[model samples]
Target: MISPVIPEDSRFESDPDEVLGDNHGLPAGWEVVPPDPADRFTVARLTHLLRAHERQGRGWAGSGVDDVLVEVSEHGLRTRENVVVRDPEGEIRAWGSVHDRSVGRMLFVHIVERGLDDDVAARCSDVLVEWAVGQAQAVGAARGLETQQIDTGAFQDDERQHAWLAGAGFERVRTWWQMTRPVTPEEAALAESPDHWEKDGVVFRLVRRSGSGLPDEDDLREVHEVLEGAFVDHFNSSEETFEEFLHRLREDPGHRWDHWWLAELTDGDAPQPVGALIGTVSESSSGPDGSYVSYLGVLEAARGRGVAKGLLATIISDAATRGRDRVGLEVDADSPTGAAGLYTSMGWTTKYVTESWHRDVRVSPA
Candidate 1:
C-alpha cells in the first residue's frame, strides 16, 4: 500500500483544492480536503482511523503513526494524492489515498471509520472508489496510456470491505497468504555468516555498498535485471523502470541497503546474476523488530538450483543474527513456484489472508 513516490505528473494534475470543491456524492455537511501529514491532529486522526479499520477487519493493527504519515508526506505526495473526509462536526470520518504506482497500475486506499450509520459508511466508500477511478484516468492520461488498473486490497474475512469493493465495480483477482516465521538464536547457524555464502556452485550475498554507504549502481542494475527477468511470466507482472524500482524500494521506512541480497550462479568461469531478494526491517513498538521479505525473485533458469531457498535462508539467518523476533512475507496463494510449500517447510505459517481487488478504467481522449 506504501512505496516511494514516482516523478510528479505535471501534465495531468489533480488539484487538491479542486478535489474537495465538489462533493463527489458525499453527504451534505461532509467535506473532503487534502490531508496535511505535518498536522499532528490530522496524523493522529488518520492513525486512529487506520487502527480502527485494521482492528475491525483483522482483529489487530499492523500499521503505525509513521505509516500514516508517509502517505501524505511531501516526498510521498510526488506520486500520491490523499484526502480526509470530515463530518459536520469537523472530525475526520474517512481517508482516501491514491498512488500512481506504475504505468498501468494505480494503487488506492479506501478507509472509512467503523461504527457509523451503515448507509453513511457505504456512501463514503462509494465516493472514495469513484474518486479513485477518476484519479486513475488522470494518471493514465499523464502516462499517455489508454487504460489504467485500480488495484486495492481487503482482508479476506472483512465482509464489509468485500461488499464495498464489489459495489464499486472491483473484482477480487488474487489472494495472498501473509506468512511469518519466528527467528531463534539457533537458526543463526542456517548460514555460516550473514556476509556471504557459497554452496552447490552458487553464491548468495548482500548487494554491495560503497564506502559512502550507497549501493553499487552496477550491482543495483543487475539485481533489478534479475528480478525483471524472473517475474516476466508471473501473474499480473508489469514492467517497471529501473528508476521507479529504486525510488519505490528506497522510500520504505524499513529500507536498509544491507538487507538487499543477490545470488549469482558461479558454475562457469564468470558468475552470472540469477536471483535477487530485497528485505526490510519491520519495527514493532512493543517488541523486538522483525525482518520482512519485500521482494524475492529467481530467474527461470535458476529455479531448480536452490536460488530462492538460499535467498530465504540468508534472510532468516540475518534476522536471527540481528536478534529479530521473526521474519514475515506475503506469497500468492496460487503461485506456480510452490513458494508457500517452501516457506511452510522452513517453519513459516500463514497469519492472515488478504485479497486483491482490481478495476480497469479507460482513459478518455483529452
Candidate 2:
C-alpha cells in the first residue's frame, strides 16, 4: 500500500484549538511527511526536539545533529518521512518517524516530539499514537504486517520522559547502563599493552581497515556468525540478519573498521578467529568528554580466555593513542555473563541507568 503523504505547508504546528476543531476530544488531522533526502533543516529540527527532551541532566558530549542527519539520510535502512501534528497556521507541535521494517511485518517507531506543556503534551501524544496505530494497520492490511513496536527511551536522567512513556502504555523491557572511565596521564602510564595477553594459545590482534584492508568476504561472514552466536541469549536478544547488522552500522556516522578487534587461536597449524569485538568511538557533547563504545561481544566458546578483556584493552589503548579523554560503553544491568563486573574491574563506573519499555500489540476487530 502507498504510504500517506504529509503536505509541506503543514510541517510542525499543533495548536490546541486546531486539534480541538478537527475532532473535538478525538485526535484527527495529523499528517506524516516524508523528509526529502536533501532536507537537512527538518532533520535538524527533529534532532533538536529529541535532544532537548532526551539529554536532560545527562552528558550530551558525544552527540551531534549532523551525525543523526547522516544516519537518517545516508543509512541503508529505509526511513519514513517525519510525522507531524500541525495547527492551522502550519506550526509543528509534535513529530516523529519509523524506520527499518523487517519482513514488511514489524516496524519500529520513535516519537521525537510532544507538546511542551503537560496537558498539551498529553493531547499531542494521544494524537500521535492514534496516527501510529493507523499507520501500522494500513501496513498490515496491505503487506500482512504482524507486529509494531515503538521505542520511547531517553537518557537515564530524563525522569519526565520516562514517565511519559509509561503513561503511554509501554512497559520497561530492559536497561542499558552507560558507563565511563576517565583517561588520565597516570592511567595511561598504568595501562598495560594487551599484546602480552593470551588465552588458551589464542592471540589478540587489532584490525584496521586500510583503503586496501576491508575484511574479505570470508572474514565478514565469520564476524556476523560470531556476533549472532555470542548474544543469542542475552536480554532483549533477537536474531538480526547479516544485511540488517551491516546496514545499521554503515548508517552510523562514527563507524570505523579500525575500531574492531579479533582474537585468533594460534596453537594449531592454521590461525582462526575465535572471538571478536565490534565497536565504534562516537563523539558527543555530553558525558565523559570523548569516544563511546557502541557495542562489544565475544563468542561463547571464546569466553574464560582473556579474549574479552584483551579486546577491551585494545580499544582503550586505541582511545588513548587518539587523545580521547575518556571511553564509554553500555552494558545490560542484568547481563547473565557478568560483563558488568568485568567493566567495573577495568575502572569504568556507572554514569547513569537507561531503561527500555515495551508494549505488545494486539489487533482488535474494527
Candidate 3:
C-alpha cells in the first residue's frame, strides 16, 4: 500500500496490528482492519467528513473519534469489534463500530466517504455492515442470549445509508427529534417558582449521593427502577439491567451526580420516588451554553399530575439559577405519549431529525 495524502486533521504517528473482519482476497487496494488507538486522528478526520456530508458538524464537540477509540480501549469492548476500511494507498475511507448496549442489543456506527464512487462506497458499507453483524453475534455468544439485535441510525435525509441498512436486513424503526430549548438571556432574570408546577402532594429532590462523592446505590437503583417502569411501554424500549444503565451513562463525559433529580410524594406513610430526571452538561449546539436532559422518566402512577412539568421546572430553574443558557432534550417523533407535544408546550422545539434502524441476529452463547 502507498502512503496516504494525509490531511492536517487526519495525520497520524502510527503503531498497529490485527484485522476484525474477513479481509481475505479483497479488492486490490481495499481491506478491512481492526481499529487501533493510533488511528484516532484518522478516524476523527473521517468522522468530520461523514458528519459534514450529513450536515452533522454544527454542534459536534470534535471528540467523537478520540472518544470512541478511548471507549473501546478503556472499556471491555474489543478492538476487533471496530474496524477501518483503507484504500490501497493507506487512506481511511470508512469506519464501523458496534457497541453492546445491554440486554441483546448493539449500537452500530458506520461512516463511508461520499466522495467515493457509488459502487466503491456500497462495497465498503457492505463490508462494515458485515463486520457489525459479526460483532453482534460475538456479543450474543458472550452474553448467553439466543438472539441479539443490531441498532443503527442515519440522518433522516441520508437515503443512501438508509438503503444500505435495508439491504443489510435492517428495518426502519422510528424517528427522533433532537430538540433544543434556547435559554433567553432574560430568562435568568425571571423568578422561577420552584414547586409551582409540582403536584400538591409531591416534592422534588436531587438524587442523594454519598459523602465519598459517589452516587448512593440505593438512589441510583431507584432512578433505574423509575426509568424502567416509565419507558417499558415506550417505542423500541428494551429490558436493560441497572448495571447496564449506570455504566453506559457514566461513559458520557458530561455525566455528573448533581445533575440527577427526583420527583417524590411523601405525604403518605413513606416517600415515593415516582419520577426521575437525568441531566448532563450540554455541548452548546446553536444555542447558548446549557444542560441537556438525557433521560426524563416518570412512573405510570405519577403521570398526568404535572410530574413531567415539575421535573422540567426543576431543570430550568437550576440552569437559570446557575447562569446557564438553556435546558435541552430530545423526544420520540411518533411517541404514543404525546411527548413531542409536551415538549413544544413547554417551549422545546425540534432542531433536527434522526432515524433508527434495527435488525436481529441469532447466536448461541459460548
Candidate 4:
C-alpha cells in the first residue's frame, strides 16, 4: 500500500520534520525534498525556473511571483504535493507538483532547468514523472478510485516537453488556443445597455455580493450548478463537489467576487440559472494588467440565446472600466460548440497554443 502525501496546516513556517516522497531514479548528485513555504530563497529560485521555462517554451514569460507562490503556499498544500530538486552544490534545478484536482484526476507539473545536458535533463524528467505515478496511485487509493488520470500540459512549440511527456507514457489529447483581445477605454460603453441584459427572454448580470463583499451563497451555488450542468458532456468533465469548487477557486491569487457573472432565463415563473462566467485579474510585470476568463459555461438549452456573448461583453466592459489593457482566455481548439468561432468573431486571436497530455495509472485494490 502507498501512503498519500499528508497535508500541512502550518502557514509560513518551516516544517523540517515533514515527510516527503522518496528520491528514486535521480542522478547521483541530485536530491529531492519538499519545498519550504517559509523560505524566500527557495521560492525565488522556483519563480526563476518557472519564468525561464515559460520563456523557453513560449517565447515569453507571463507568470508573476504571486502566481508561482500560490502553488506551494500553505492554502494550496491542502490538496497538492510539491518537491524541488537540488544539484550537488545545493542549487535548485527542477520543481514538480501534483494536485488532487478531483476524484480520479491528478494534475502534474514537471519543470526542469533549461540548458542542462540533454541526458541529465531527460533523467530529471524521468524522475519527476516516476514520482508522479506513485502520487497518482496514492491519491487514487485515498479517494477510493480504481484508476487515476494524470493530466499535464505543454506548449505547442515545446518539442522538449513533448518528448519528455511522451517518454513518460503521456499522450497528447487536446489542443487549446490561448487567445487575447486588446481592450480600449471606449469599450466601457459596452455595459451601458443596462445592469441586466435581457434577450430572447434570458437575463444576464453579475453575481450578487453582500454589503460585506462576500458573494451570496445561494447565487454562488446557482453559478456552480449551472457550470456543472453545462459541461456535463464536454471533454474531461469531472464531478467536483461544491465545497471543492469554492476552495479551489479561492486558492487562485487573482480571484475576485465581482469577476463572477451568471445568466438566467426569466421566461419561466422564476429565473433559472443557465450560464456562468468566472474572470480573474492577470497582473503584468511589464505592462498594464489584464482580465482572464477562467471559466465560461452556457447550458445547452441556452446555447443560441447569446448568454455567453453577454457574459463576455460584461467582462470586457468591466476590464475597460478598470483600465485593463487586454482580456485573455483559452478555448478548446476542437470544441463542437463552436466556441472558438465565437471568440474569433469577437476580436480574440490565438497568441499561442497549448496541448494537454494525459496518462492513466491503475491503483491496486486495497
Best model per TM-score: 1
Q: Which stretches of candidate 3 lie over 4 Å from their true place?
A: 1-26, 38-40, 56-71, 76-80, 185-199, 285-287, 364-366
Which window of ten consecutive residues has the lowest lDDT sum in model 3?
Answer: 10-19
C-alpha lDDT values of all predictions: 0.86, 0.60, 0.72, 0.84
Considering summed lDDT, which 10 consecutive residues are worst modelled in model 4?
10-19
Per-residue lDDT over 82-187 for candidate 2, one digit per residue giving the tens place of the 0 to 100 score: 4555545545556655443433333334544533667666666666655555554444443344554544455666665567667778777778888988765444
* Ten contiguous residues minimizing lDDT sum, candidate 2: 1-10
The collision pairs in model 1 are: none
Tens-place lDDT per residue, model 1, 217-300, is 889889889999998898888889888888877778899999999999998889999999999999998999999999999998
Ranking of candidates on TM-score, top first: 1, 4, 3, 2
Task: Report how far off residue 265 is in candidate 4 (Å).
Answer: 1.4
What's every prediction's RMSD, in angstroms? Answer: 2.5, 6.6, 7.8, 4.6
Ranking 1 against 4 by lDDT, winner: 1
**Candidate 4 lDDT by residue in tens digits, 1-366:** 112333343211122123234545567878877888789998899999999999999999877678777788876777887888788999999998888887778899999999998888898888778778877877787778899999999999999999999978999999999999999999887865424666677777888878877788888888889999999998898998887788788878889888888888898899989999999999877789999999999999888988888888888988998999899999999889899999999999999999999999998676
Evaluate model 3: give its lDDT: 0.72
Please write out the lDDT profile of model 3 over residues 1-366, one tens digit for every residue.
112121222111111122232443347877776556555676566656556555642333334453554444535343225667888987878877677676777888888877788888888888777767666766677667788888998878778888898999999999889887866546543324432334577777777667777767788888889999999898778888776577667767778778888888867899898998999886545655588899999998878877788788778877776668767788988888888888899899887778889999887456
Greater lDDT among 1 and 2 belongs to: 1
Rank by lDDT (best first):
1, 4, 3, 2
lDDT score for residue 46 of model 3:
60
